[model samples]
Target: MAVTYLMLARLPEGGLGAFDAYESAVLPLLAEYGGRLERRLRTLDDRVEAHLISFPNSEDLAAYRADPRRSAAAPLLESSGAAVELLAVRDI
Candidate 1:
């Protein structure tokens, strides 16, 4: 079965200056890993974001996780002092 994920994040004191760059880099890469960005939402504060993502399967998810290029967003996030939470969703 396909797998889904929920992600919530809080950005740094400087706010969303780097969000566009991060999104640009990460979103395109998803297709290569059989992943999809279901939805992305940003708060009015511009200091937080959330995502709904899905993947073909656990293997695809694992491959994406293991990819070094996947860390493309890491610098933006780390420098921003971001806080991220991810949850796996399964059928009820």
Candidate 2:
């Protein structure tokens, strides 16, 4: 079964750029693990950003999470002071 994720990130004013850089670097890594980015959105005020991501299965998603490339980008997120939330979701 496929699995989907809803990621909501609260960005700090100073860190938004850093967060964007992080996403640019890491989002592409999804393909290596049978994953895709369905949608990405951001508030006009730039305070929040959301992403809809899907993977073939939970295992693939887990592997993506463990990928060193993604891990290496952690500092970008940390420096951006972004608070992130990821949730599993389903389409009705």
Top TM-score model: 2
Compared with the true structure, what per-residue lDDT tens digits does model 2 show for residues 1-92? 99999999999878889999999999999999999999999999999999999999999999999999989999999999999999999989
lDDT of 1 by residue, 1-91 (tens): 8999988888876846676566666778888999999999998888889988999998998888777875867786566667889899765
| TM value for model 1 | 0.84
- TM-score (all chains, Cα) for each model: 0.84, 0.96
The numbered model that scores best in lDDT is 2
Q: How many backbone clashes can be found in candidate 2?
A: 0
Q: Which runs in model 2 stand beyond 4 Å of their true positions?
A: none
lDDT of 1: 0.81
lDDT of 2 at 66: 95
Candidate lDDT scores, in order, read 0.81, 0.95
Q: Which pairs clash inside model 2?
A: none
